[model samples]
Target: MSMQTSIALGKQYLLDTYAQVPVVFAGGEGMYLIDEEGKKYLDFVGGIAVNALGYHDAGLSAAIAEVVEKGLLHCSNLYYNTQAIAAAKGLCTLAGMDRVFFCNSGAEANEAALKLARKFGHKSNPARTDIISMVHSFHGRTYGAITATGQDKYHVNFDPLPQGFSYAKFNNLESVKALVNEKTCAIIVEPIQGEGGIVPATVEFLQGLRELCDQKDILLIYDEVQCGMGRSGKPFAYQVYGVKPDILTTAKALAGGIPAGAMLTCEKANEIFKPGDHASTFGGNALAMAGVNEMVRRLNDPEFTDAVQQMGSYLREKLVQLAALYPTLCGEVRGMGLINGMVLTVSPRKVVDACFERGLLVASAGYDVLRFVPPLIVRQQDIDKALAIVEQALASLL
Candidate 1:
């Protein structure tokens, strides 16, 4: 089908939510996506960090095809499946968590984590149901997740949100401490804020939060939806700082592009949710679990993670150079691993569009930050090409 025809049909039938780019991708190979017109665009955004292994991966594709051949895509949570069991074991081992609850999408994962925190808190005291989230943080679109999000813009027009949720200044320990009370049940944070401009939490801040949570008997949750699964040069972002949380939420690249999310819990928080407490019908379907098992296997390799670290440093060095070259158009360079951002003095949207027109795909976080989250398998050469296009885009803006 023609790109224009497909877009016209989508506009007529689809919900008016996303301001989508004017391209319809037909297929992908390695680090590039082929549009309907046979144009190849280097995909730096990686479907907003969902395509970790990149497109048409041999192992992931074979695993998914094997699942398809089995013809048992979903057995539901009523019965145990081997694929789910294997995936869970791999994830638990990598994350150092005792248990996991699978779901579809990052939003659902965050919802499950929030529910678990509330229930765990209620066991101690009914009034301890409040959750503290960091300011400028993005959780998910669901009621509970959105309410826990610290940005007012996301909450606007969605009135009468769930109460007992308050915002603390990002990286400000005092702000978090002041909000703590008997009613506070948990504190949720992103080690590196993806949607809020690729800001990494200070080491002292995360360590302090851990200490505070330990003293207050509150659950500390890490939302690794965008930064986990080796995106941070580690199995999870918490490992980067060596500060473990009681609960960790992950999705996006969790199932190798398959729609899946998981809320992993430490031993203490693992016992909070009984079988009847929370459940998802399509959470750990065999199809998604197959992908998960393959991804986890690859991510567990030390050599693979080491490459990610090296490439991340190479990408960061290139971005720092880009910022220096265009001082007027760029500001601070922030991020860890592949999930990096450059503060743009010019409008990020214009730069993004310019790159899109030049056969590259990038995204914007907040209003002025250009976010880059390429596939984990992205090589140094790919970084060179993407940054060349980015430099061109910046020059055009000038």
Candidate 2:
């Protein structure tokens, strides 16, 4: 279908939640999306860090195809399936956790984590149900997730939200300490805040949180939804900081673009949830687990993660140079690994549109930050091309 026709139909039928771009993507190859008109756009957004292997990856495609051919996409969580079992084992091993609960999205994973935290706390004392989240953090869109999110913009109109949630300043250990009390059950944070303009947590802050959690017996949770699955130059962002959480929620790129999420728990937090406490029907669907199995195997490779670290450094250097060239237009360049953001003096929407026109796909973190989360397989040449278009877009705005 034509781009206009497709967009018109979408506008008429689909929920008006997103202000989508005009282009209609037909398919994707390595590092680029082909539009309906056969216009190839460099995809630096990586489907919001969901396409970790880029597109049309041979191994991922074959794994998923095998699952489809088996005709066991979902056998229900009541019975055991090889795909789910293997995927669970692989994820737990990769994350260095003891057990995992599968879900369908980042929001679901976070919801499960929150439930686990509350239940674990209740085991000790009923009043210890409060959760402390960071300011400017984005958890997910579910009721519990939205309530845990620190941004007021997402909470608007969603009144009478779930109680027992409070926010502290990101990277401020003192603020977190001030909020902590006997009621605090858990503290959730993103090692690298993805939607909060790609700000990474400081080492001292994370270490301090870990120490405090140990002392107070509070469960520390890291939401690596956007930064996990090799996007952060490691299997998980918390590994980079050398601080382990009692529970970790991961999704987005976990299933290599397939819809999957997981709430992983260490030995301390593993036994909190019994069978009836929480469950998801399609949480560990065979098809999604097949994708997860392949993704985890590929992401675990040392060569692959090493390349990510190298390319992340290269990308950061290029972005720093871009900021230097236009000091007035851009501010600090902040990120770890491929997930990055450039603080802009002008509206990020204007620059994003200009980049779209130039056949480069990027996204904005908030109002003034341009987010770059290219696929892990993105090469130096692709980065050069995308940055050229970004420079062109910035110049156009000027």
Candidate 3:
């Protein structure tokens, strides 16, 4: 089918919610996507950081095929599925948490976390209900998740939002102190704020919050939905700062492209639910769990995680070198792992369009921040090639 036909059909049938580009991918390989007519593009966006292992990974394909051959997709919440149980155990073991609640997406995982925290707080004290979040932090698009996000742009359209939500400054301790109160149930934060220009929290800031949560008897929630599952060069980003959360919500690459997520908690916090305090209809389906099981096993490997760390360092170093050469377009780069962004005074949107035209798929976090979240399995040579494309696109702007 022609791209125009596909777009026209979408315009007629689909909701006008997304500002989609002109490109429509036909299929994807390891790190490349082909258009309907067979124009290959090097994909660095990774489906907006969702495709962890890139497209059509062998292991992931095999896992999905096996699950399909078994003839199980949506095994309802009645009986236990092998994939769900094994997937949960894998996440629990990797996260060093007590239990897990699997779900279909990041927003769902975060919603589950919010529900769990509210219940835990009420269980401890009925009046303790309010939750704290940092400004500019992007959680998700759900009603509850939108309310929890500190950005006003997301909150402007959705009024009468859920009460008991507060905001504080990022990377500042005094702001967090000012927001905490007796009614506060939890504080949700992303260790490295992804959508907010890839800004990372200070070590002292995270450690201080941990200590404060310990003293104030409040649940510490880390929304690792974007930064977890080997995106941050570790099984979890919280591990890098030597801090742990009472509730850690993860998604995105948890299933390496399968629609899956998880909510993890300490042993004590796991007791918030007895037999059935909360559940999801399609939370831990057999197919999603099978994919998740494979992803979890691959990520749990030390060598794989170490390679991610090395790739991240190499990419960042290359960025720094380019910055030195071209200070006009490239301002600076910052991130924990493969999730890095290059700050610029020029419009990143234009750069993104230029890269797209050059057959390099990337994304922009903010107006001036060109974000680069390549697949974890992207090779060093691929990084060099991507940088060359970025360099060409950036030089044109200069």
Candidate 4:
């Protein structure tokens, strides 16, 4: 279908939630998307960091095709599936955690994590249900997850949010300390706040939280849904900080765009959930687990992960240069690994729109930051091209 036709159909039927750009993607090659009009645009957004290995992945495609041919798409939780078992083992090994509970998305993974936390809390005391989340942290859109999110904008019109969620200032140990008490069972944080403008937490802050959580017997939940899966150039962002959390929630890029999420817990919090406490209907189905197996294999490789770190440094350096060249238009650049953001003095949407017009796809993180979460497999030339397109887009604003 033509781009205009597809867009018209979408406007007629789809919800009016997103202010979508005027383009319809037909297919994707490595690191770029081909629009219905046959325009090649660099895919720096990576479908909001879902396409970790980029488009046209042979291994992932082969695995899915194999599963399709078997005609065993789902067997429910009643029967055992080899793919699910293997995926869980691989994820646990990579995460250095004891067990994993699979789900469909980041929000569901987080919801499972919260339930695990509350279950663990109630095991000791009935009233220990409070959860402390960072001030700007973006968890998810589910009732419990949205209630746990720190931003008030998402809370609007969703009145009577679930009780027992308090907000603490990001990177402020004092703010966290003030909100803590006997009722606080868990403290959820993003090692690097993704939607909150790609902000990274300070080392001292994370270490302090570790110490405080230990003292208070609180579970430290790192929402790695955005920064994990080799996006941070490390296996997980918490590893970069040399600290670990009691529980971790991850989803984006987990199954290479196959819609999978996992909530992993260390030994301390691993066995909190009984069979009847929590479960997902199609969480670890064979098809999704097939994708997970392939994706985890690629991301767990040392050479590939090292390249991600190197490329992240290269991308950050180029962004720093761009900021220096256009100080009036840009602000500070933040983030680690491939999930970086360029702060803008102007509205991020304006800059994103300009870049889209110039054959590049980017996204906005918070209110004024342009987020760049290219595929982990993006090459140096792709980075150079994306940088050039961004520079041209910024120059157009002048």
Q: Could you tell me every candidate's TM-score relative to the true structure?
A: 0.99, 0.99, 0.98, 0.99
Q: lDDT: which is higher, 1 or 4?
A: 1
Better of 2 and 4 by lDDT: 2
Instruction: Name the regions of candidate 3 deviating beyond 4 angstroms.
Output: none
Clashing pairs in 1: none
Q: Tens digit of lDDT per residue, candidate 2, span 211-264?
A: 999999999999999999998899999989899999999999999999999999
Candidate 3 lDDT over residue span 1-398, tens digit each: 79889888888998998988887788999889998789999988998778888888999999999999988887788889999999989989898788998888988889989988899889878999899999999999999899999999998967989999999999998999998999998999999998988888899999999999999988889998888989889999988888999999998888888888889999558888766877888889999898889888898799898998999999999989887788977898899788999898888888899999899998998567889888889899999999999889888888
Off by more than 4 A, model 2: none
Given candidate 2, what's the lDDT at residue 28?
94
lDDT of 4 by residue, 1-398 (tens): 67788999999999999888888888998898998888899999998989998999898899999999999889999888989999999999998888999999999999999999999899999999999999889999999999999999999998999999999999999999999999999999999999989999999999999999999999999999999998999888998899999999999999998999999999779788887899999999899999999988997789999999999999999999999999999999989999999999999988899999889999999999999999999889999999999999999998
Least accurate stretch of 10 residues (summed lDDT) in model 3?
A: 267-276
In TM-score terms, candidate 4 sits at: 0.99
- The C-alpha lDDT values of all candidates are 0.94, 0.94, 0.89, 0.93
Off by over 4 Å in 1: none
Which of 3 and 4 is the better model by TM-score?
4
Highest lDDT against the true fold, candidate: 2
